[model samples]
Target: MASNTNLTPPRGLEGLDLLASAIIILDDDNRVVYANPAAEHLLESSVKALSQLRFTEMFLNADSLNAVFRQATENLFADWRQDLTLERSGREPLHVHCIVSALDKPGMAILIELRENVQQLKLDREERLLDQSQANKELIRNLAHEIKNPLGGIRGAAQLLELELPERHLKELREYTQVIVKEADRLQTLVDRLLAPHRRPHIVGDVNIHEVFERVRSLITAEFPSGLAIKRDYDLSIPEFRGDKEQLIQAVLNIAHNAAQALAPRIAAGDAQLIFQTRIARQVTLAKVRYRLALDLHIIDNGPGIPPEIQDRIFYPLVSGREGGSGLGLTLAQTFVQQHMGVIECASRPGCTDFRILIPLP
Candidate 1:
């Protein structure tokens, strides 16, 4: 029952939309012609809205864009590269490593490529790392000071309520207090999870990524215990990279856990398979560096899959698709990996979901 409308987009443009990179196309007059999905999201607007604005209207430093636009138009060239700062309303301006080129069959149209602001992105990453470091410390202290006492009280109340009521009524009264006790326990667990990353000391060393994958596989199997398979398609020749082994383990573990959770029903149906794929990528960009070599690790699952509603915000803190999920796992994973100058990206459809992590090789 597939619709045959030929809706599949041209491969290059489609790939651009899926990428975390921002892209914009401009005409000879420097008018906005196209803005990819990432650019639209980054700018907090749509292609339609962006199309109404000139390159100057969107980019705080329009001169560089204008200069390049003129050059491409005058020379009929196919490519240009520069780093420029882009300013959007409300948000602080962003620095972008830009690539521009005239389209083959074009009077004025030019392709615009964007990479994240290296300096700003680096500062933001470090600032968030510091913020998370401090936040976790406060989270631990506050949770210890605040959660434990109330949780004890709630559990105590449930036990006392069971003693006071008649047997039949005891179940109901205990259940009420039990709800409070359970929630408090869940909150305590969540606080611990949030504090875990910050509490650990860095265990820096050369890490074989496949070993990390094997560890994740073992851990996931121990948890799932039934009806799930961890399939590996690895290129074992990838070189060892400098990193915190335990942290990378935790990062990969978190992502695998989410995939396993998503595959729960499929596991029950005996149709679930989660795959670990590793390969070496060349000329790859992560947090904006065009590294000569990068580690490409993929975790793919065949499950019911993630809904589209919250896909864009999946890496944001405290977002989860599961009931009672603390939602801190993926957020923490992203934070941890990003600390090592890496990126984690996800793609999902009806029965398949994939999370890819790319880190520069050292």
Candidate 2:
């Protein structure tokens, strides 16, 4: 372990020392020889403090990196390597990807990149859940199909039976038929909703994202003309995207609509503002793909903001923060965006709320 501390290092080491992602370099003994600014912030300790500690104290294992970490290390070839999870705050684990490299001398250097573990776990769990939900949807669709054929026969049979029965008995039999019909209709509605995502043909073409935003703006204004303001902050330089225009409209609408709802009280106070902005981002990654041409769209609202309790499940089906909400809008929006190989992320604070959507162009 290198014990010497350089409060003011050279520019190269200084650059890595200031990264936002958690970064730490360990010697052959796994002692914290050099810890960066990001690592200090991530671990809630300064480099001076971290320099005296061992990596094993923070990471579960340092002697032999786990299979996941080993594979990641091999892939990056030490240009930058990291693949590990650390438990902090005595709470949930954090997923991190790291970049490793050999120092100019004999020791090793590692850079830790942080990612939201909850999101990763949620994605993994939801993948299995999506399969289950898909199966249930298919079953419901088939069942609805099967019931439609027999529903008419059953209703007709009840009518015929009613005619043959006493007037008093006819009423009771008719009620039974009505019950069956009503229940079937209710199931039919659910089936239609479940099948809606799959049945809608994907319309792929060059989409004018600004046009979609304009449509959303007009619709929101139509719905909430009073006490609510819609603002546009678009980057004209952004090019057309390859996507379904209607689906993108709905996807953006759902989020914008949610923002409007959250701004209800503020809208009533005549203090609500919703901003729609677009920009071109370079070296952006969406749905795990690094793309040079990326469209960045942000829906910002000045409102109370989403409650912390339900923020994590905002994209989940049937989960809503508002009463009487079907809770499928955001879920469907997420589904649509994911299909376009894009990502939708939300960040909320007391006075500001932002929903960012990133999609590839060309």
Candidate 3:
């Protein structure tokens, strides 16, 4: 014998809280009835704080979202708008996809789902960068091999010609041969460096990012001893991760060295500064993989920032912002970091420049 009473569904929204997309429940009057954890994170407000406000209060242009909500309620179906802008005061407006559906329960008339458009853009950008890096590596390797073969033969021929020249009357001519040999050697070294990242075996070990920073600080201070000040703001709680120690050192050194060169005038005037900051980032997505924890290392410099004209292509091989620069330092640094499953990003202005490195932590 079964009871005649009907069983009611659970009133709490515990299931909605598990979703990565932001979820907001609204009452018939459009006031917020519930907000999940993802919604709290997206709004930068707690669930309790959000519940006190109406849906229209959270955005500058709420009319568009409201229109969709009205249609969904009237039709008794779900509706969604793509690339809708949600404005926040004192912050950049966010582009989000808004989904609205009517709920059958009382006091929860509608369910709204918000997904950030920037996140998809980030994923696409990472995919493009990874593809570009692979193409660059292949091009460099093939080009370097072609150049290397001719280089050895050129040097050998130059030396042989010098030995075969008339000993008594060809001293001045011998100098030309010597010049050819030196130039060939220089080119050979350049080719070797171009292929270095691919040829070198990765050495794995526990790496303290702070240690790498300290090493770079010491080296940079030694070179520009007088004017530049190196500052450290470290989050001591960040645990060590595994990586290639020497490669990390070289990657950071190249970036710091480039900054030092950019700060030449300020360095001479005794006012240059470089800051090394380390912190732990939570819920970060890098190279299409979401990480629970990632190491955020920022290298900040107080100097005339990167010129706006060439800012976009700074990481491309042979694209130097400074005159006489080979433009390979940053390229090599980007390669090394990418090999460690990390990414480097830069933000520059007239007086401040920041290079941020993000690597997942185990």
Q: Relative to the unseen true structure, what is the C-alpha lDDT of residue 109 in candidate 3, on a scale of 0 to 100?
A: 71
> What do the candidate models score in CA lDDT, each in turn?
0.76, 0.72, 0.85
Ranking by TM-score: 3, 2, 1
What TM-score goes with each of the models? 0.60, 0.65, 0.72
Tens digit of per-residue lDDT, candidate 3, span 153-184: 99999999998999785888998999999999
lDDT of 2: 0.72
RMSD of each: 9.0, 7.2, 11.9
Query: 1 or 3: which has the higher lDDT?
Result: 3
**Which runs in model 1 stand beyond 4 Å of their true positions?**
1-184, 222-227, 283-292, 338-341
Candidate 1 lDDT over 253-273, as tens digits, reads 999999898888888987889
Best by TM-score: 3
Clash pairs, candidate 3, are none
- Please identify which of the two predictions, 1 or 3, would achieve the higher TM-score against the true structure: 3
